[model samples]
Structures are given as structure tokens and as C-alpha cells.
Target: MSTSTSADPRERILILGAAGRDFHDFNVLYRDEPRCEVVAFTATQIPDIDGRTYPPALAGPLYPHGIPIVDESGLESLIARERVDTVVLAYSDLAHTQVMHLASRVVAAGADFVVPGAHRTTLRSRRPVIAVTAVRTGVGKSQTTRHVATLVQSMGLRVVAVRHPMPYGDLAAQACQRFETPEDLVRHDCTIEEREEYEPHIDAGVVVYAGVDYGAILREAEAEADVVLWDGGNNDLPFYVPDLHIVLADPLRPGDEAAYHPGEANVRMADLVIIAKCDSATAEDIAAVEASVQALNPGAEVLRCDSPVTLDDPAAVTGRRVVVVEDGPTLTHGSMSFGAGVVGARDAGASAIVDPTPFAVGALADTYERYPNARGILPAMGYGQGQTRDLEATIRAMVDAGVVDAVVSGTPIDLTRVLTVDVPLVRARYSLREQAPGRLQAALRRALGR
Candidate 1:
């Protein structure tokens, strides 16, 4: 059975994840456990995150030789080569069937497939927590999180947001990070994704913390915050046991509330369910999602909200054929045809949304192949120098092709800061405002005991 005999033969565990939840699983679930040893981390989703080490600084003293981070492609061979006894699937946003496919492979490779429950990895925080999560990746979780932070601030509570970890760099240095200023982002060597999430919070005048060691990050956040905001990632549940749990469901993806992993768990556990994108979706779609939420979780309060896109420069968009660039994750894994960029562009009277497919290059080209949902918009994909360059080149090609007059970026951060597109690039921004306002405000008031 390959059961552990003693200290000499501990269970060699390999964790499968993209980067975020995988590291959190190890930190909270098995970092110092004497019965198991985390042999390696298999990364997917985020690019170039593999071929690195889960550095000894974060790996702890027992594992002086930092655990290796490898691509999930070699899962079977790595399982055999590392003598892995158990494989914990720690990432999020996969279909149940897809999750089971990997589980089948793990079982075939002669290792136990473990999916730790939401409660298993959740840490207890010293302060009160308000967690914002979603039923899917692009269900406007980030916007909802921003709204919660704003409400908390409105109440005059000193709130610090603990974003789900995006520690794609040096784990040791990123063990407990705080991003209060633009310099903090540069200091941490923040990637485009990290900046997209953190910069908005900083702009909102709320401090944000994220990194490898969430326990340490929580403590650091708790020291200053009257309440800690758990800004969740990729349909995963709150990393902390929350005093208030707000879950967002996308009307665009009606049945997904009960379909995906951990996300459905989030749906069941939520104190409040937000049927977001009410403005963009049809009545039937909204009712279907609301019905699903009600059927699955009748006790939870459901609020309807609209995510309206606003263009920074409406004049720049009107009467122009624009190359629209939406957030990368939303377009890729989130499987959306368009985001705020396309919506804002159309609303602003844009002549047409230029097709970036013809100009796609490198990972951007591969991204189109991987997820064909992006029909008229480009994904603002910039995981590294190569991807950023590819995005710039694609946008430039669209301009050079004379199909687009300007660029409209729907990412949270300014694309110009990271990439150089030859044409004028305007940003598309969106925020959550409840259709029935008292529902959200009242819920927050009760949660915070105001």
C-alpha cells in the first residue's frame, strides 16, 4: 500500500496547481507535517511559472533543497520519478469532468488523488473577515471585491485586503508582501496579473497584501486592519474562515454555479449571492442563474447588480475602428467572447471591433488556439517579456493592417505602462453597483455590526 513505515519513509506528496492555491495548500496543509513531504509543484495556467523552485526560504528548514516546480505535462513521469505517494489537486476553475480526468491519470500513475476541502486549507484570522469569491473566474469577482472594500472604507473601518496569492516569483521574498504604493509593485516585481489586481486597491487607498505565506500575510494585514478583506482568486473559496461570505454568480454562464469545483462549494457556503452582469444579460439568463442560486442555496440572500463599462475617453472610441484588449484571464480561462473593452467600445459608438486573430503572435497566437471564445477582442496577456512583446506586436500589427484606428484596453491597469502599442490606447473600466442598493449596504452593515 506504500503506507509510511516511519520517519524514514514519509509519503512523498506532489501538488498540482497553477501557482496560487497550490502554494497555499502546501503552506496550510502540509508544510511542516512529519507524515508527508511535498516533492514538487506542477504548475499550469500562468506561463513560465514552472522550471523554478519553491525556494528553501519558503520550503522551510526540513526541505533544505527547495521543492521543484515543473510543468503538469510530465505529471505521470514525475510521479514515478519522485516516488510520489499522493497527488493533491489544489488549483481551481476546472470542470468536474476535467478534474476527474486528471484524477484518473493520477490513479493510473499509482498515486492517490487528493482534493482538500474548502475548510481544510482555510486559516483562522485574528480579525473579522469579509470574503468576496465567485462561481467562475470572470464573474466580476474583482469588481465585487472593490465594492466591498469601498463599503468597508465608507464605514470608516480600517480595512486591508488580503488578495489570493499570485506568487509567481521568488517565494522566499514574496512570503509576506504588502503593496501600498506603486513602488511596492515594482519592488515585488509585480507581473501584469498582479498589477491588474493590486493597483486598483492601491488607487482606492486601501492597502493590499498577497504572496506565498498567507498565514504571515494575514497576520501582517490584521495588525493594521480593523477588518481583513479576503479578495479571492479564480473561483476558489476564501482562504480564511470569513465572518461574511459574498459570492458572485455570472448570468452569462447560467448553470456554472453548481458545475465547477470549489466554486460550487463557494456558492453553497456564501452568506450572500450576487447575480452580477444584470445589465448585460437577458432576463431569462438572469432568472436561470437566480433560480440555480435559490435552488442550491435558499438561505443565502441574492442581490442583483450591473457591471457597466465606462470608457476613459469616449471621444477616442466613437467613430473609430478600435482594437479592443480585454483582461487576459477573463478572455482565456474565463471563456468570454468580450469584456468591458468591447462593451465600452460599442457603447461609445465605435465603428467596429477589429479582429486581432490575424495579428496574433507567440503565446497570444497559442492563446487564441487554446481558447477561441475571444472573437473580436485581444487578450491583454503579459505574463513575461515575451508575452508582453507579443501583445504589443499584435496591437501594432492591427494598426499597421489599417483595420483599427486606436486601441481600447479593458484591463484594470494601464496597458501603456507595460507595453508599447503605437496607437492611442484608451482603458475601459467597470465597477459593480447594486440594482437594489439597500441589499448590499444592509448586508455589509449587518456583517460589520454597524
Candidate 2:
């Protein structure tokens, strides 16, 4: 490994990310710093994200040719080749041990490893911000955020939600996106994962903003809002400094609150700890999660909520052999075995839950190999056009073999909108129902003041 220092006075940096947080961190901290030159970004988690450039338009004037995104497996080589002075980790949903392992590798390769301080990177918002995050992915953050938005609107305040970045395609075009109608999603050519998060907000008549440059996104969102709602992604903390920080912990994954990297940090900083899915989780599990929360943040107000799962067309799945498709991020990186589709199927007395493994194709097959935790059911892993096609093919293969009679889709958005499957696609929905109804509103009043 070459260790010779660069002749230039500026420090060379390499950002390790899964596509979302890395760009935001660079834009916020180093874009115009003049002392740091970002040599490259290493990509992981999402597929087909590598081998692309950050695009000069969004990279600012310093990087005229733009920065290259290489595969994460080449981290050590890139560090040596670029003589990187610092390596910054800007991803989410990783265990503490996993983070340490990466740190050790960076140090061994003769580069400094840095996890940027959460507070240092967070931008101050002019509008009163209410941030809804989770101890891990699939902890019902979307439902909780929507509920908070409704509460703010009920007080006669105009509210706008800003989602965490998921700019998988065209960084320049996705610098700052606003979604007010279904047509906006089409105009942007949104993937299933993008639609899953943005469509629900649009359906509820709330305007949503997302994309690469959060500083630009925030300015636009703040202008139209009495309150800014930060809808966090993948167990990550909010990008904006929040007046009310509400963190959701899942009872199903009881001890996970203390196990993950930034997730545990979120627990410690939360103003309110919401134990979601009380109806689905057993009493013992619920108590275990609550005990962990109390141990972490004794001052935080804890509340229980039910995640009631229901099927839009129960008859489509009631007596049929069905293939259940759940939210991708929840199953793959979120590390959950099943989602609402499985629960709704069993509740509706489906004949049998067909295993989709045998019918997996291309990217879908690769996903199963990577995340062995996702079993029996299929994860809706559509990050790009090819992955979406693979998902469609895998489902059709199951139907062609006559293994399943219908499809149970538990994704937040309607799957029929994107895929044209041969079988009847039943939509399974889950929503947040607070156990102590008035408590959340009461807390909101205390934080925001009616």
C-alpha cells in the first residue's frame, strides 16, 4: 500500500455510504470547505449503485469532473491509491460490531476512520421541527410521522414533511423533489421503495420533499410550512435539529434498540419513546422493549401503540395459497423475517403461505443469498428498473408454476400501480393506533404549544 503524503495541502477524503447519507454529509460539511478534497465515495447496501459519478452540477465548482462511486469492497485499495487522510462512515442500520470492524479495517489500511457527530452535521431549521425516527427500520416511523403531521394540522398550522434522501437515480434531477400528487411520482419515475415512502404522504394530501441536497430541500419546505416534519429513513437520526424528537421501538425485535449503531444513539436522544406494535407483540416482548427504553432514557415519555394489520380484499387471500410480498428495506437490511402480509395472511386463514425462493430470478435471487434472514416471503426490493423487473418476473414465475393462487402485497403503496401480475393482488395494510389516544396530542401541545 502506498502511504506517501499528497503534495497538495488539502486533505484527501473518502466517504463510505449506501448512497443516501454520504452525499448529504459531503454537501453539508465539505462541499465548499476549501481544506478537504473528497476523492471518492464507496457504495454498498443498495444494488447497482456503484460505477456512477456524483455529477459535476451537484458536486459544486471545486470538483469540476465530479467524484466517482466505487464498490465498497475496494475500500483499502482506494485509500492507498488516493492517500486518503480520513474515511467517513455515512450509512445506517448497521450493528455496533459491524461499525467497529470497518473502523479496524480503515486503521489497518493507514487511514483515519470517523463517524461524524450527529449533532455537528444536523442543520438548524427556522420552522419548529418534529422528527419521527425509529430504533431500527420497519418500526412504523411512516405511520407515526403521518400522525404527528395530522396533529400539527389539527391545530390550524400548515405542515410540510421532508423525507430522508433516497436519490437512487439522476442525482442532478433529484437534488430537491416535491411530491403533491400521484402524477409527481410518475414525473420523477419513482421506484417501488421511493413510492412506498412518498405515496402515503401524498394520499393523505400532505406535500412531501426529498432528494440529494437537503440544505436546498429544507429551504423550499420551510417556506410553505408552519411546522416541518422530518420523516427519518432506516433507523437514522433526523437531518434537522428537532423541537420534538420522537423515536419508535419495535416490540417484535425486543433488544435491537441497544444493539444497532446509531439506533441506540437515537434512543438516548429521544424526547418521547413510542413502543409500537403492542397489539401484534406479546406482553412479555412489549415489556422487554419498554424495560430497555427506560434503562436508556429514564426521562423520555413512553407510549404504547398498536399496528393493526388489515387486508383490503380479504376474499382474495382467505382460502387461497398465496405468495406474500412485504416491504423490501424492512426484510433485507431491517432484518425482519416477515411483515404485515404474513400476519394478515395467517389472520385471514390463507390455505398456505407459498415459499418464493424456488421461483426467484436474477436480482431477487441475489437478494435471498445476501439476506438469508428473509425467508418464505418475498421482499419488494425495487431500487431500479432491472430490480423491479426481477421482482415482477419472480412473482410471475410463482404463479406460472401454480404454486400460489393469489398475491398478498404488504407494501405501503399499491403494487398493482407498478406491476401487472397475472394473479389477483391483495393489498395488506397496517396503521398506527395509539393506545393512550390523548397522550400524544397532549405531548404535542406541550412541545409545539397550541
Candidate with maximal TM-score: 2
Put down candidate 1 lDDT per residue, 364-392, tens digits, no spaces: 98998888887567887877767888988
List, in order, the clash count of every candidate structure.
Answer: 0, 0
Every candidate's CA RMSD: 2.2, 1.7
* Full-model lDDT for every candidate: 0.88, 0.92
Q: Name the regions of candidate 2 deviating beyond 4 angstroms.
A: 1-5
Model 2 lDDT, residue 150, Cα:
88
What's the lDDT for residue 7 in model 1? 53
Model 2 clash tally? 0
Listed in order, each prediction's TM-score against the native is: 0.96, 0.98
The regions of model 1 sitting more than 4 angstroms off are 1-7
Q: Lowest-lDDT window of 10 residues in candidate 1? A: 1-10
Q: So what's the TM-score on candidate 2?
A: 0.98
> Number of the top candidate by lDDT?
2
Check candidate 2 and list the clashing pairs.
none
